[model samples]
Target: MRRYGPALLLVLVGAAILRISAFSALYLRYVQAGLRPYLIVSGAALVLLGIAMAVVRRSADDAHDDDGDPLDHEHGHAHHGPRVAWLLTLPALALLLFPPPALGSYSAEREAAQRAAQGVGVFPALPAGDPVELGVGEFSSRAIYDSGRSLKGRTVRMTGFVTHGDDGTWYVTRLLVSCCAADAGTSKAEIRGADALPADTWITVTGTWHPKGKLGTDAAWPPVLDATSVERVEQPADPYEKR
Candidate 1:
């Protein structure tokens, strides 16, 4: 068992990765969809490597036994290292049995302040529609930086989890990730006309822009939406917006 400890940890980790990346959409919680293929390949490699390692070690052990050698007599001091190494498999087991949830209100609320846009200008005209479906990040960008007022008079819809401010303010929030969850940024809109729902509740909001402060100013940040309708919805399979 000690001889196979390292190989077992590798297999457990590989199995956990495969469980999320190849067998389900659960990988989206920590990485972008485009990364799924890489993850699948890595998992397969780990599994094969582990199996090969275990086979090689077994062959070596059998050779030692055939020579009438005591397996632990000469390496008794090294045995403790393998025993301690078994603890490394706990993280792999946790990933298999209890994969973590996607970032939600708690992650959003941790943002100290919204980062300012690099530049302010007119964005392309929105497609013609009664209610335009927009990502939370896109809406926030247009609201704060568009000098041409792209969102004005437009009924826009966005879906995100709910988060609350200390002042009793609530927001429709989503996290934006450039590469993965570790680099996530928050985007949200303060809802003006609707009652606050429980934190982390996924909701689709339809509303018109409620202009606040001057465009491109910190005071204009977060933006505002006068929600005519707010309906609870199931969380999306891929929760983070691509940054």
Candidate 2:
């Protein structure tokens, strides 16, 4: 067992990486699609490194040790195995036992940077149709940055987790990632009549946009939604949007 320590660590690390990328949508919680290939490459490299190390170690075992000593090696000392390598399995085991849920109300309730802070500029043209369904990030962009106030009369549908604002106001929020979770920005809307819903509940809301504060400027406040309807929905496969 001790002889295989370094190889085992490499294998476990590789396995963990592969698990996140393949087993579930767990990878989506931490990163966007652009990064998936890199993870797979890294995992494969680690696995190959692990296999190579094992082969080399086996080749240089007792048969090749200097002076017929079981542990003597090129460093002129006993080659003890990598005891700390055991720590490598921790992340693998943890991820296997409990793949983390997507960024949810528990975290969004804390409310990081709002869409205003993201410095979004002119929003794109609205889609063609009533109650146009849009991602939370896109919806917030139009509500806050579009000078035309494109959402004034149009009903739009957004899906996100429910959370509470600093003022005990209920909001539907989604985390928008530019690259990964480390850079996630928040997009949220104050739900005018849906405060009764529990925090963290995932829902689809159809509503008209009404800004809580001034729009077309950089004032920090959630976009307002006078909800016409809200329906409980399953959390999306990937809870984040690439901005």
Candidate 3:
């Protein structure tokens, strides 16, 4: 049985990878799409390794059984290690049972003081359109520091989960990730006349950006949106914004 220990771990780990990547957006919540292929390959490799280990163990057992020595059974040629190795499966099981959700309002609140340092390039010119669709992170980033003040006249649309502040303020918040959730940063904009939606509810607010104070200030500064309309919306498949 001890020989099977490595096999058990491989199978469990592999199953966990496949389980999460196959059906759930678990990978997306933590990492980017480029990792999905690697995850699948790793899972398949682990399962194959486990199966190979089991086959070798069975062959060894059969070889031992073929020996004419009856004492072979009592001699205990098998080495089934301690049960503690089973703990490895807990994470896999949890990934299956609970499936952790993406960072939400609580996370945004905790990171309120930290804003995205200058994102990828000069904020790209708003693509030609009325009520341009914009990511929460982009809106927040530009609002705070873009010298051009691009959002001033644009009727922009941003989608994210709602969050309530300690001061009874509402914000549309989204996390920005350079690579994965491990490196996640937060972006947010204060909302006015939000229709008082419950916190953590997903919504798309279409409106215009109005300057509050100086752009690009300290943590106290945030992009403000005077929402012309607020409505509950479904959560998008990929929720995080790429910074």
Candidate 4:
């Protein structure tokens, strides 16, 4: 434990900083209301645990002896003195200072390729509604598997950031990531009558699924959703899907 004292201290400080940042209203509200308390408590616990571990390890190390045996001497030195483990926190600290933007062009292309190969027939049909919340990741995966068969001719309402095109049309897109934004895939349905769409504006769209064209290069996966109406909406604090 003493060998990892610096690492433990770094962990404690990192946890504290992250928690404080998250607790700030502007940042907290942008993430999600439901998750705020959980994050706060968990972060606090992590900080406290790290501190306690470091202290206990230091205390134990102070009571140990410097033996002449090579292995013992090495172990004692490694555990009883300052170590390099704390360096592991550098990248994390950098990230906290400069959070990356949402997954963009690269993710979009990857998602398009994935949809192309798998197809979009399996997506569940959207029930008729003025504002239905559709999970972008779920919908994309289902479409790839089932080709939007379940969503045939049904209207769906979805909310997401707007991605604009040069042709005056805009898409309400969300990234479906496997782990983080770095590996996320993008998915979107067309929004007609959305000529005035604003980039990055969280909006709710109501539309019906219409088999218009093929998804990607494959004729097997067909396009779905022709939006009837679009309205800007608030961004959820926790933007990521729960599952």
Candidate 5:
């Protein structure tokens, strides 16, 4: 226990640092709101356990020595060895000083932005109404994968950034790619009769899906939506679709 105490302390400090950082949300999902108190108690316990182990080791070394050598000398005449254990505090200190921002433009183009190819059948059918709560990522993924079956005549209401095209028509597009912008593929459902194009404007669209033609320079498979109405909307806190 004495020999391994410093390693255990390092692990506990690492956990504490992660709990207090931007990755806190990820940990909260597993540990719940009690993480703060848990970190406090666990950190104190580990620190005390480590200190006690070090003290016990020192006492044992003194008892076994007959030459009257210092405990530090017996371990290896290095003052910095014990101090190295404190490096575990660096992550916590950095988080306390500078936390990172939420995932932004960097993650905007990830494939996760697109809908999953599998489980398209599990999505609920669009209900007939003025506004329908459609998961834009899921709807787009389904439309892309099983275009003929999923959205041939189905009406959907979606919200996303508006990007302009060369023809003066604005496309309501969401980037779908794996990881980041480099691999991002666009999943666009057209917005006809929409004027006053606004780049990156968050907008709500109510429309019925129809196969029109090619979209963009890639000449990607075109699955257009004949929009009934379009209105600008405020950006949501979690703008991206959660898989």
Candidate 6:
């Protein structure tokens, strides 16, 4: 068993990857959808390599046994692998049995300062509607930089996990990722008129924009929403927005 440790570890990690990427949509928690095919291929390759290694090792052991001298038979085959190497499997097992939840309020809060947009400019007109659905990142962009005030009178709906601030302040927050969770950045809107929800709770907020400070300034950051309704909802399949 000890001799097969490396193969076991490989198989376990590969299976965990397959469990998240091929068997379900859980990969979205950590990476973009475009990466699914690569993950699936990687997982399959690991599994195959592990099986090949195990088979080759087993065959070698059998051949060694068949030609062994009487003196050699009296002694046992020694496994020199370090016992600490088994610890490496823990993370694979954890991923297989209990995959971590998507990044939430804690991750959002870690970004103490927000990055500013390029510059204030006119954004394309939004489609004609009463309550337009918007992404938290897009909303933040328009609120902070759009000279056109595209959101001024429109009722908009945005969904994200709730995050609380210092004071009694709370926000509907979304993490934007370019490639994966490691590069995730936070985008959020301060909610007014609605009661704060528990941290990490998913919610759909309907509100109108509440402009702040001059556009293109730090003061306008985070933006503001005068929420008319706050409805708890399940987290989306793909939680992070494209940066």
On TM-score, the leading prediction is: 6
Task: Name the regions of candidate 6 deviating beyond 4 angstroms.
Answer: 70-76
- Candidate 3: how many backbone clashes? 3
Per residue, candidate 4 scores C-alpha lDDT tens digits across 94-129 of 545545444443345345434525433444455665
lDDT comparing candidate 1 with the true structure: 0.91
Ranking by lDDT: 6, 1, 3, 2, 4, 5
Give per-model TM-scores.
0.95, 0.85, 0.89, 0.57, 0.47, 0.96
lDDT of candidate 3 vs native?
A: 0.80
- Give me the candidate number with maximum lDDT: 6
Candidate 3 structure quality by residue, lDDT tens digits, 1-243: 565777877888788888777766678888777788888888889889999989988887787788857788546574567778777778867876777888888787787475445532346688888789989877877777777777778899989999888888888888888788888877888999656688789999999987876656674367789999987898887788887
- Number of clashes in every candidate structure? 0, 0, 3, 19, 3, 0
Q: In candidate 5, where is summed lDDT lowest over 10 consecutive residues? A: 213-222
Using alpha carbons, what is the TM-score of model 4? 0.57
Worst 10 residues of 4 by lDDT: 24-33
Give lDDT tens digits, candidate 1, residues 1-243.
777888988999999999999999999999999999999999999999999999998886676666764555355325535466778999999999999999999989888875954578999999999699999999999999999999999999999999999999999999999989999999999998999999999999999999999878899888999999999999999999998
lDDT of 6 by residue, 133-213 (tens): 999999999999999999999999999999999988999999999999999999999999988999999999999999999
Flag regions of model 1 displaced more than 4 Å.
69-82
Our tally of clashes for model 1 stands at 0
Q: What are the runs in model 2 whose C-alpha is more than 4 Å off?
A: 65-77, 81-85, 111-123, 217-220
The lDDT per prediction is 0.91, 0.76, 0.80, 0.57, 0.55, 0.93
Q: Quote the positional error of residue 224 for candidate 1 in Å.
A: 0.3
Tens digits of per-residue lDDT, candidate 5, 1-243, equal 334546455555555544553344433312334345655566566556656767766776566565566764566434235656666656655544554433333344332333333432334455675455566555555555543354556667888777665576666765543433234455655577556456777788888766543322122333566788888897654344433
Of the two candidates 2 and 4, the one with more favorable TM-score, higher being better, is: 2
Candidate with the larger lDDT of 5 and 6: 6
Residue 9's lDDT in candidate 1:
86
Please report how far candidate 3 places residue 11 from its true position, in Å: 1.3
C-alpha displacement of 33 in model 5, angstroms? 13
